[model samples]
Every structure is written in C-alpha cells, then in structure tokens.
Target: MLEGPEIHRALTRIAHEVLERTKGAEDVTLLGIPSRGAPLARRLAERIERVESRTVPCGALDITMYRDDLHLAPARALGRTEIPPEGIDGRVVVLVDDVLFSGRTVRAALDALNDLGRPRSVQLAVLVDRGHRELPIRADYVGKNLPTSLRESVTVLLEESDGVDAVLIGPKRERGEDRTDEARTASGEEN
Candidate 1:
C-alpha cells in the first residue's frame, strides 16, 4: 500500500497539516501507542521540529492495560506509557497510531488518556486509515485513506520493528491456503 518514500512524504504532509490545524505546536504533544506507533510519533515530531524549527514533545502510550479485548485475548506484556514533562493537562494531545482499523484501539487510548490527565483537546493522527470502522472515530490527520475488505489484512512494517518500511494489503489466508507469488507481488512483499 505504501513504501518508505511514500511513508516519508505522508509523514511530512501530516506534520504540516497538524501544525496548520492546531495553529502550531505551541500547545501540542504527540503520544504514540506502542509497537510501530512509537517511532512514527518520533518521526512526526522530527518533521514538526523542522517545519516549526522547534522541538515538539513526543512520548509513548501503552494501551494494553486499557484495551477492551484484554480478557478476550491471552495475557501479554504491558507496554510503556510515558508523558512529557510539560504533560498533557492543557495541551492539544495527538494520539498517533500506524493504522486505524476498528477504532477500538483509539477508544482504549482515550480511556487511558483519561487516567493520565485532561487535555485541552484530543486529536488523532494515523499513517493509514483502512476503512472498516467499527466505531464512530475519525482521524484529524490521515496519511492515506485505503478502502479494504474485512477479509483482507493490512500490515505496516517499520524499520524499528519489522526491519522494513512498507504497508502491504493482502487477503487473509485460511488453513491450507498456499502463499502464491501473486499475493506476494500485490502485497509488495518479496518471496
């Protein structure tokens, strides 16, 4: 769906869009969810710093503890949630995530943020918005809007985690379904 260069361009645009929407980062803070969102947040902060010529505060937010499906799934290790020194009490807090699927994660993030502190406003920034929204959630800054099927799967691989930066959309394989070259090529994955 997106390659490294595409991802870079998207982040750049998102950074500018964010500053424009908030009238600059004077009252902004970016909090990324764990896994891929953490580095994406840093990247956005870097871009914001370049455009604004000022460092933007960025931190990691772990929503494992606050997820609605925690009991439905097996137990996993909790992620780290760190707020900046200035805090989110009165800043425009942007929740950064790699992809927006069902909106449950964002919903959980909101619950988690509620425990932290009240922000002047809350916004969402996502690299890709794959349309299959299970809740009434929207992204303030979207890198791309991808329309996909419920039977499909979108995977975002970043260098920090997957050693590559690419967003691949492919069909979800069932048991005994062979991985074909067609799927690999279409998904932008090398066999």
Candidate 2:
C-alpha cells in the first residue's frame, strides 16, 4: 500500500520525468483509462499545471467495448472517456491507469485511441506494475514495481473510492475454492 505522501512524491517525480522527456508540457495531453485511472490523471494534471503554470488537457477514456474479454464479461459496466476539446490529433497522448496487469487493457486503449485520432505519440503511466504481462506493453512512468503472484489481487483504494488512497495486496486464495464462506463466517454468519 502506498501512503498519501508517497503517492504525492511519485506524482512529483513523474511530472519531472515527463517534463524532462517531453521537454516541457507543451503539446502534451493526458488521457486516463476510465474508472480508477481518471482521478490519477486529474492529479497528474494538477501537478503538471502547478509545475508548468498551464493546464494540460486531462481526458478520460473508456475501453470496455474495445477489451478482448468483453465477451467474457458482458454485464460489466463502462467508464467515461473524455478527450480534450482540441482532440488528440497530432498531439502526445499519455494513457494513465491504476495498475498494469495483463497489458490487455492497454492494448484495448491503443485501439480506442486509434479510433479517436492519429496521435503524434502515445505513452503509458501506471501507479503499480505487477508482472505477468500477456502483451508487450510497458509503462513510461511507474509509481512502484511490485512482484506479486498470479493468485494475489492488488487492490488500490483511492480517496474517491475509499476514504483514503492506498494500495493493498489482498490475500491470495486457491483456485476453485469459494472464499465467500470465509468472509461470511468472519462476519458471524453462514450461507
């Protein structure tokens, strides 16, 4: 789990890295992968503004339909993808996400970006990087590098979603075993 101070420091460092790599925030835009990624993008945008004295357009992108596993989870809800009024045409687009898991979401995001407009360049930023990538995607900016097993789940609680923003490594459970019973029993109940 990352403390608020740690997150702040990471954002500051990422801003510096972005500025250094892009040679300032000119012609730069932030596109957060919807849901958890939105707030992170907004925070990054705010930090960038503080450093550059200019508002970098922060947009949200929803890639639910574009995901390869959509058919597997048809009932899943979607997120919002808001592009800047100027659009992403000929601009550098940086995609933000909470956790980099299988890299499939990033691939879907790339497809979604292509549908929007031809970007001069596209980069990735993530809060946490867990291994087991099913694709070749890599984050341009990362907050932390965590080595986790495939069975373990990484839960990121943002201030918006959770009272406080922190990353947690949830306990791993065995496959085909129902842990709901354990949860219910711990709550003094049975189902």
Candidate 3:
C-alpha cells in the first residue's frame, strides 16, 4: 500500500518523533530487531544525528532464541545481535521493527533484551502497525497504523534488504505453502 518515497517520509517523521519523545534522544539506544529492523534503526539514527547534531547508538537485536513459538517451527538460523559499547544499562531502549502484527516478535525482543541488561525504559517503534495483537504490546512510535484482516498479510520491503521500499498487503498463504520471508513476517510466523 506504500511506496519508497512514502516509506522514507514515514521514517523521517518517526525519527523526529523519537527525538521529541526522548527529549533529544541523548540517552536513547535504538536496537533493531533483525533483519529489516537493523537497517531501519541505522536509518533512524542517521536522521536523528542530522537533526540533533549528535550521534545516536544503533545496533541489531536478534530475537531468534527468545521466540515463544520456537518449538512449533523448524530449525532457524540465528541473526546477529550487536550492541553498542555504551550498552543498554540506564538508557532508553527503542526496539525498532519493520511490521507489528500479533506482537509476538516484540515480546520475543523484550525477553531477549531482559537477558542482555537492564534499561532505564523500553519503547517500541515500527514502520507499520497492522493491528491484531495477540499480546498487550503497543508501539510508542508508529510510521503507519494499517488496519488489516486476519486472513490478509502485510509485508514491509526495505531497500537495504529488498532493494525496494514498499509496504504490501495481500492474502495470507495456506498452511505448508511456500512463501517469501516477507509473507512469513506478515502472517505473524516470523519477524
């Protein structure tokens, strides 16, 4: 439903919101939930720096082992988790993600964050918040609030990974059917 320019504008707005919410993001550390989140976090950091004239720590958080549905799925490759040297302790951590659907991924990210270190506070930021939350989680900063049916899927394609930036909505795949990673993410089967 969204194209490249629109996605860029949304990210720009989200960056500004993060700065405004955190009062300049002085002690904020953005931890992106890989794979798309990592790049998104970097982009946010860059935008924040451009506006505030200071660097914001950005890194990737891998939630593979912390997922609640690990037993239900087959073996999966773990993504890289890179924390800045400053660490999360006493910092306002913003967990960035591509799409928010059932909130499972965000929950998994929170669990993983707990194992790492204690943060002053934890907040969530997402490119698309396609509601149907299975958990009580909600995003602190959202690029778009997309209302969708349970049978439909929302996919976010980023330029860093997908070579094109777009938010697509389509039908969910049948059980055991082959689908792309984006489709899997939209179906709330992966993050």
Candidate 4:
C-alpha cells in the first residue's frame, strides 16, 4: 500500500521520533532484523545523522535460530547477524523491522539479543504494524498502523534487495494451499 516516497517519509519521521524519545539518541544503537530491516536501519541512521550531526550505530540481527516455529518449517539458511563494535551493552537498543505482524519475529529478536548482551532498554520501530500481534509487544515507532485480516499478508519491498520500495498487501495461502516459492515470498510468509 506504500510507495517509495511514502516509505522515505515514514523512515524520516521515525528517525525524528526516535531522537526525540531518546533525548538526542546519543547512546542509541539500532539493530535491524535481517532481510528488509537491515537497509531500513541504515536509512534511519543516515537520517538521524543528518539531523543530530552524529552517527548512530546500526547492525543486522538475524533471528532465524531464535524463532520458536523453527521446527514447523524446513531447514533454512541462516541470516547474518552483525553487531556494531561499540556493542549493545548499557545502550538503548531499537529493533527495526519491515512489518510487525504476529509479533513472533520481534519475540525471536529479543531472545537473540539476550544472548548477545544486555541493553539498558529495548524499543521497536517498524515500517508497518499490521495489528495481529500474538505476543505482548508493541512498537515505539510505527510508520503505519494497517488493519489486516488473518488471511491477508503484507510484503515490504526495499530497493536494497527488491530493487524497489513498496508495500503490498494480498491474500495469504491457507494450509494445504499449493504455494510456489515466488508466491510464498510475495506473501511475506518467509518474513
């Protein structure tokens, strides 16, 4: 539902909100959940730098191994998790992601973060909050609050990986429904 310009505006706004909430974001470190979230984290850092004139450490945090539903799916290739050299200890960490759906991914990310180091506090920032949370979690910064059905899926395409920036909403395949790899990815089933 969101186009390139809209996404940029959202991220820019989120960057400002983060700075305001963190009181200049001097000790803030952004950890983006892999795939779409990585590039988003970089963009936010850039925007934050532009306004605050200071660089914010941004890195990728892969939650593949931390997911509770790992056994439900087949073996998957692990995503890269890179922590900034400054580290997350004693810092305010903001977890960035493309879409907040079931809240499971954010849960997995929290578990992964615990293994890494203890942060002073943790917050969430998302491009879209689809409102189907299965956990007691919420995002501190949200681009859009999209109402969607369980049978619907939200896909975020970033220019860094997808070569385009857009958000698409479509039907989700039901169990036993024949699904192709392309369809699965498009439906954000893999996100």
Candidate 5:
C-alpha cells in the first residue's frame, strides 16, 4: 500500500509524465473521477504548473449516473459534476483516479465524458492499477502497478478526507460475512 510520501511522489511523477505524453499540456484538461481523484487532479495541476509556468485546467466528474451496474450495486449518494470553463471539446482530457480495479468505473467515466463533449483525445491516469480488469480498458499513465485479489479490497485514504494518507488493503467480505473489523495497509509486503 502507498503512504503519504509515496502518494506525493507518485503524483509528482505522474504530472511530469502527463506533460511529456501530451506534449506540454496544451489544450489539456485533467478530469478527475469523483471523491479522491478530484483533489489529486488539483495537486497534479499544481505540479504541472510548476514546470510549465502555465496552469492546466482541472475539473471533477462523477460517473454514478452513468454506471452500468446500478441495478446490482447498492444505492449511494450521487456526486456532482463540474466541468472546466474551457470544456472538453477539442482538448486532451486525462481521466484521473485513485485506483483501477475492474475498469467498470473508467467505462462509466467514458460514457459520462461522451455526454459532456467529444474530446479531441482522452487518456487515463491512475495512482494504482490493480490487476483483474473485467473490461478491456487500461491506464495510459499509472503511478503504481499493484496486484490484488478479488476477495481483497483496495481503499485509498487521502489526507483530504481520511486525515491520513495510506492505502488500505484487506479482505472484502460478502453480504453474510462480518464487516465490523477494520482493514489494514498492504505496504507492498504481502500482496
């Protein structure tokens, strides 16, 4: 699992990689998935600005309404979507997220983005890419390539919300299993 310093380093590296991949961040919009990614997007934009001296557009996008598993998944609060003033049309939009698991979220994000506008190009950037992607989607820029089991869950605790920065990985209990206990960080010791 990733710690505070680790997460910071990853984002710094990711920001540089994004600029390199997009060729100087021109017409680029960093659209982050709701919750964790929104803050991460702002951090990435700041890092990019340090190098380029020009600010890159940042926005928050929520895919709850566009998800395909609504019928099966539990109901949750819908998140707000805020697009940048520049919009996504004719720009390079990089979708940012904390973790990549089954890739369903990215799929939903793609749909949500399509409804917003047709970007000249879209790319993906994630802090962690845990294997077992149910969809064919893959991240273009990844901070870390983490491997996790289907029975395990990866929760990214950002300082913005959790008050501490760390990645928690633990057994994912089913409906009948006990869910009272807390999860632990993997720390890349025992995946």
Candidate 6:
C-alpha cells in the first residue's frame, strides 16, 4: 500500500510531466472519471495551479452508462460534471483515473466525453498502470507501472472512504479452491 507521502510524490511527478508535455496548463482542464478519479483530478489540478499559477477547471464524469459491463452491477448513481464555465471545447483535457487495467473504463470515459464537447486533445493520467490490457488504451502520465497478472485486482482506498489513501494489490482466489465453503456460507451453513 502507498502512503500519503508516496501518493503526494507521485502526483507531483505526474503534474510536472503533464505540464512539460502540454507546455503548461494554460488551456487545460482536468476531468476525472467518477468516484476515485474525481478526487485525484482535483488534487492534480491543485498541483498544476501551484506550479503554473493558473487555475485549471476540474470536473467529474460519470461513465457508468457507457461501460461495456453495465449489466454486471446494479444501477449506478450519476455524478455532477462541471466543466469549466467555458466548457471543454478547444482545450487540452486530461482524464484522470486510479488504476489502468483493462482500459475499458477509459474507453467508456471517451464515449462520455464525446457528448460533452470536442477537446483539442485528450490524455490519460493514472496512479497505477498495471499490465493486462483488454484494449489499446494507454496512459499519458502514470504514477507507477505495476506489471500484474489477469487474476489480480488493484484497489485504491481513499481517506474519505477507507480512512486512508493507499493502493493494494489483491490476488483473486482460484476457482474451486473453496467452492464447498462458499456454497455452505451461501446456504447459511454453520462451521
């Protein structure tokens, strides 16, 4: 798990990279892909503002409807998206997310952005860029490059929810490893 100082360091590095690549955040807007990304985007925006002395608009996007696996979960709550008062037109947009694994979330974010407005360019920024992409999407600014297997899940717990900001890599349990126990639990069986 990453400590607060480590997370701050990574965000600082990413901010510098973004500023260097985009030549500053003069005409840039930070758009976070809902939930976790929203806070991350806000944090990055602050870093950019302090470094460049320019305020960049930070917005949250809800792409649940655009997800490829929409049917897997129950209905998702929509988030408020406040693009700069000027909107995303002709601006350099940086999409922020926690972990980049399968690239499906990024894909969904792109689809959602299309309805908002056409930006000058869109770049991705993520904390962890774990290998095992189901699509071709890649992050422009990555905090850490963690090579992981397909059966592992990287979870980011924020201070707001988990009372701490940390990254954890959880290995998925193998199939049939505890089927009997799982079934018993489901059936309300005692130990």
Give candidate 2's whole-model lDDT: 0.77
lDDT of 5 by residue, 65-90 (tens): 88776675455466558899999999
lDDT digits (tens) for residues 14-104 of candidate 2: 8788888888978889998767788889999999999989989999998877877555432345567789998999999989888887888
Model 1 per-residue lDDT tens digits across residues 48-155: 998889989999998878877667544556667889999899989999988888888899999999999999999999998887777899999999998888788777
lDDT of each: 0.81, 0.77, 0.86, 0.85, 0.80, 0.77
Per-model root-mean-square deviation over C-alphas: 5.7, 6.2, 1.9, 2.4, 4.3, 7.2
Question: After superposition, which runs of candidate 3 have C-alpha atoms over 4 Å from their true positions?
Answer: 175-191
Where does the lowest 10-residue lDDT sum fall in candidate 6? 182-191
- The list of candidate 6 runs beyond 4 A from truth reads 173-191
lDDT of 4 by residue, 1-191 (tens): 99999999999999999999999999999998877788999999999999999999999998878878778756456667999999999999999999887788888999998999999999999999889777899999999998988878788988988899999888885532443333324324434
Give the per-residue lDDT of model 3 (tens digit) for 83-126. Answer: 99999999999999988988999989988889899999999999
For model 6, how does the per-residue alpha-carbon lDDT over 134-191 read when each residue is reduced to its tens digit?
Answer: 7989999999887777667566766754577888777765433443423211111100
How do all models score by TM-score?
A: 0.89, 0.88, 0.93, 0.93, 0.89, 0.86
Decide which is better by TM-score, 4 or 5: 4
Question: Model 2 Cα RMSD, Å?
Answer: 6.2
Question: Cα deviation in Å at residue 84, candidate 5?
Answer: 0.4
The backbone clash count of each candidate, in order, is 0, 2, 0, 1, 2, 0
